[model samples]
Target: MSPATALRRNSDLGAALAEARAAYAAARPRSAAQHERAREVLPGGNTRSVLIYGPFPTAMTRGQDCRLWDLDGHAYLDLCGEYTAGLFGHSEPRIHRVLHATLEEGINLAAVGQGEERLARLLCGRFPSLAQVRFTNSGTEANLMALAAARAFTGRGTTMVMRGGYHGGVLTFPASGTNAATLPLPFVHAAYNDSDEAARLARAHAGDLAAVVVEPMLGSGGCIPAQPGFLAALRALADETGAVLIFDEVMTSRMSGGGMQARLGITPDMTTLGKYVGGGMSFGAFGGRADIMAQFDTTLPHAGTFNNNVLTMAAGGVAMGEIFTPEAAEALFQRGEALRARLNEIGRQAGVPLGFTGLGSMMTAHFRQPLPDRPYAASPAEEALRELFFFDMLAAGIYLARRGMVALSLPVGEPEMDRFVAAVGEFAESRAALLRAGGIAG
Candidate 1:
């Protein structure tokens, strides 16, 4: 395309996005009012930064099965699935029953309950690495404790992390630099999915390295799965260097009943877990080699006010043991795999610069320039296209993260899957001209 043509196409794209943003704002009057009211109390009318977007976000009023209804009366298919925490769907009956019973029985009991032990035993039996476990309030806490354990166990201060890895809120390293809110720690950032880079970092910092923390699949960071053999290399490196390997399965645990470690056959020294493990409740857990986890021995000073809360214990046990059985987990994984394959196929056929990256039950769509010989990196144009796609999906009655992330819940059956794919097809067709001009080359 000529420079003049490119400039005109860019202008058209900007205008189209502006019009879409207006349509989004106009569709949710009630949500706009709610946001205004909330801003008085909550900063930016949001507690979670990921949920926020320009022109305000639609306030969801209720959810059931696989759907959500915003305050403005717009219904959404809820492909976001509360970022995988709502794996059981909004109104899972088993969870309801357990929660009700636990609530009636009272919470924060002064005594240890059998339910807690039962849940721990169930987790230990399922995940090979988790010989012993400890509970926390959220995935962030789980990761925090896991790292603390690694440092204490290895008697080292430095930790190696991927550039795009997100362990917890304060433990995030989305890029080369740690965010201001990141916990103070000696961290060495390494390129994700690059076994060579990871190995080099591990060996270079061998003496100071306490742990190598990573997500089996980068959930928040564009849903990129670890390259084949990358994880095994990390396992071998950790073994060679005496560094603790911590798999932050806070998102990828849903990939299998035994978590990703079981699927990959590469067990880490420690693992952090959260999300639907708590049965759609507030929960986090970290556990691994019994000796390393033993640092939390009752004789030592370690505590969480609600670590053994009765409701979470009871509900989590049912979630893992009864509700999300091994068979159910495998089924969900298959469904996600099929859906993702179809989506990618459609994007390729359309010759749109759009694609999805992820493993079972989790994925993120990106509008990029083209496949690079190296690891994927989003360009500025791709970033704008992603934001535009978010609005397009929202208009089509699908709810997903602004970053185009999607997670399949058990309730997302064939009908919902078909609709989601159809929506993406429509979006690509509607924006074909702009996409092709931007190097999509359809």
Candidate 2:
């Protein structure tokens, strides 16, 4: 396209985005006021970085059965699924019963509780790699403990992590550089899904490498599933280099009963889990081969006030043993697979430059064609176009992450899925020219 034509197209895209932002702001007066009040203490009126977006975010009041109501009283079909922690949805009857029963029994018993062992056994039985397990308050804490254990066990300080992989808050490694909040570990970065580079790095740091941590599917980095052979290559490299291979399945654990490792038949030395496992409560777990986890039993120290809290343990037991059984997990996986296929088909039929990438029950929409295999492989998403899409989806009564992430909850049935699919089709058709002109098709 000529410079003048390109400029005009770009100008049009900007105008559309501005109009959407204005509409979003106008529609959420109460949420905006709430944010202003929060700003009195919270930075940018936000405690979580991901929750922040331009024109402010809609402050949600409550959710139930895959539906969320913002402070402004707009109800939405919740596709965000609390970033995958709402697997059982906002209200699962069984989970609620368990939580209530546990609360009645007591909380923070200050001693090893009865509920912990049962939940631990269930986890160890499900995941092939987890011979033993320990709990934490969040996935971030679980990863910290896993890395600490690996470093202590291997007697090495250097850790290898994939670029664009987010294990937790402090363990994030973006494409360009480490996030400001990242832990000061001796982290060496490697590209996601690049087994050869991973191999080279492992060999290079073989002597000092304690662990090579990765997400089987990049979660916060765009839900890009690791290519076949990539994870297997890491396994081989870790064995060769004497480095502990830790799979951060915090979000991807919902993929199956045993997670991606079991599905792919490639197990890691350690696995970190959180999200949905606690039946919607704050939770995380780390476990692996008995020998590695044994250190925690004696030499290494693992302590947390709420590690064995009755509420999480009891609720988690019900979540794993009753609600999200292996059969249920398989069914959800199939449902997610079908949903992703349908969404991609819609985009293709509309001739729009939109795509979705992910594994079971979790996906991210991309406004680019020829979807990326890794985060850095493609240019950054067109923010204007992405924001426009977000606003449009919200207007259509579908709630998803600003970054286009969608994590399906158990309560999200055919009706919710149909509405979401219809909304996407509408967006694709209405904004085809703008989407095409945003240089996403290339």
Candidate 3:
């Protein structure tokens, strides 16, 4: 398979580590005590496992510019970038002002407001594919609506979930559902871009698959962008099989002006968006064809109490207006290229397999050889190296996703990128010295 094809694939990252010692050491005494106290009330001392990293997670105080300061007062250049949602960075002055103004107008009245309609209009205008939109409070809710619409429109229960594809942590697209289910459910587990395989799976459940939901770019599963033919093939298959093609752009929307689907020139029947939509406020949305989206009006169960909360709409509107510029998106892509180039050059000098590649604004560094487009199902050693590199990166002051994806925001520019590149250089140098003492893997 081509590198792009393999990049559409997913690898097994192995385990959730507990950097208890490191996490403990990193926390201030009061913060550490708070963590200990919370364990009694909050399970695992937190609500979400995704938020808690190995050892324990840091207690964040606040963010400004492109940096985060923990409760212990240790400041780290924010590279996680709020999982790629804080496109304009934390507490941006202009966005804050807009939101503050919205608050003065009253929060909500249990009915649609001009703010909601205006935000939706801007979203639809910027994304040509989103002709009509419904605002939801979370990406999962947006995806749920998309899936329900597909099922309602197509009258099929089964949805084709790409193997290892994550869609808002939904069971309809669960990690194990693709291969293990037995009935009219998420019955297909076709690997990305394998037209023949997906073709076979669709035929096996002939006429039963309502939709084929895919992430144009995998966010949680190692930041792997789909190969070119992959999404095109899915689009074709959905048409042939009469299945709804839904692109879950929740996490991948930051990739371009219209998101990864636009970057790749692939359009689906329905597209769900979130993350950046909130613009650092809580928000989510899904939009598509006028006919298909008519399902939203079908009086089905798609309502949420805080669906289009006024605050999210106000801030997201301002954020969308500012961020949808050609200059801003282009500048972000350029920064991605510069960061990757510098990192790879240092990788060469340091003798590590460290390299970065991505489409539009998304990018990630790998500790192994230049990866193929498919999930190599990385061997045990390769997986170990990935984990070791994560901890090493932490030791070097760059906190990246344990999975290795290094998403960037508009605020992250030359200085931030340079600091990040330098960290990679130091990692590479130390890693190479270690390898020289032993040996290096391709």
Candidate 4:
């Protein structure tokens, strides 16, 4: 069916969802059938539960450049890009050629490889704050090490982080600072974007705080950027309290030339990174001051067999070789502006409140009533509507973060960007129609 016809019929989500199911059928009927068969062995029929949603998900068969092809051979402009790790885009030539070369040599080794130093050199050079760096298998492990080093350095038991700040997973920093129970150390979480409260709480635990860790932009908390001066205030509090500061830039590192903190001109004592650092492979790292990082030596073993695998190093070297160049950053920012503009325009015409959080290539959609009503309402209706938005977008050939953020990657040039804009444009109309039909209610 034509998009206009689908839009006309989808006056409510009940209808829109049915139309969405039809759209999915047209795109990957086989994938949906396969997903049903796989669900028996896999919880929710997926290795990653987040990938599962109503009407099922299309299994992507291949990705190259800025496009993804499903099992049924339907093409889509890949805006999600494996949750932002495909920053250089799928099968980037440099990374592809290098990984293939490395695989000929080996994949993982018990001992480190020369490529480890190559990737490390690029990281330290990119961020001047990093005097020493330690590799890990994922961002979750990186944050765990960051926290451990902070505690050891300060000899303090507690730390401060923002509420709704997502770091990584259980072995490290699972959930966010918002979920108080999961914090490994004595963590104090204050509402995000409120510098006054952060300062107050950090100071309250001043004598005991080892660090104040936060995301420069809250990635999972509805894509809300921290309010202006918020980060600076945390920095000051950390200094006054003698607490180490950490910037969990695993997601936000794609923003600036140096990282989000560099672009914002606010420096944290340490930073955690992963996701895209290994080209398209799994890799993670935490690095900071020479004195603090020395603890990672014999004093506290930062040793892990898989910390710096060989293949990831090769792919990462290629990724960094491309990323560290001025051209790569410029391409990211320029593309970012275009995507943001298109989304804003589409949402505006549809009478939807639309804006983005994060800088440069990492733009996440912000939809809801304007300020004074609270950016993220915890009401039941608001919660369900937010979840519903995600499923709707996916069915329309657009994937979104479980929290409704969208990360743009390198492969998305003009053609892919136009396709994405078209999807969002359809999303705007579909959402507006849903609201008018009482499928959604404030």
lDDT of each: 0.87, 0.90, 0.71, 0.73
Using TM-score, give the best candidate's number.
2
Better of 3 and 4 by lDDT: 4
Q: What C-alpha lDDT, on a 0 to 100 scale, does residue 227 get in candidate 2?
A: 82
Which residue pairs clash in candidate 2? none
What would the per-residue lDDT of candidate 3 be over residues 94-202, giving only the tens digit for each residue? 8889878877888766887777888888878766578899988878778778888888888888888776676664443333334232234455677765778888887
Provide the clash count, candidate 3.
Answer: 9
Highest-lDDT candidate: 2
> TM per model?
0.95, 0.96, 0.87, 0.88
- TM-score between candidate 1 and the true structure: 0.95
Residue-level lDDT tens digits of model 1 in 1-442: 5777545534577776777888899988899999999999999898999978889988998999999999989899999999999998999998899899889988778788998899999999999899999999899999988888888889999999998889889988875445888988999988887888889989999999999998998888878888659889999999999999999999999989899999999999999999999888899999999899777784335588888889989999999999898889999999999998998887789877777888889988866634321235566667768888899999999999888899999999999999999998987877777666553432
Q: Which stretches of candidate 1 lie over 4 Å from their true place?
A: 1-11, 298-300, 369-377, 439-442
Error of 3 at 47 (Å): 1.5
Residue 185 in candidate 3, Cα distance off native in Å: 4.1
Write model 2 residue lDDT over 76-107, tens digit each, in one string. Answer: 99999999999988889999998888788777
Candidate 3 wrong stretches, greater than 4 Å: 1-31, 171-185, 376-384, 433-442
Candidate 4 on 156-274: residue-level lDDT in tens?
98977665667775522333323433655677767777887888898788889998888877665555676548888888888899999999988877776578777788878999999
Q: Give candidate 3's TM-score.
A: 0.87
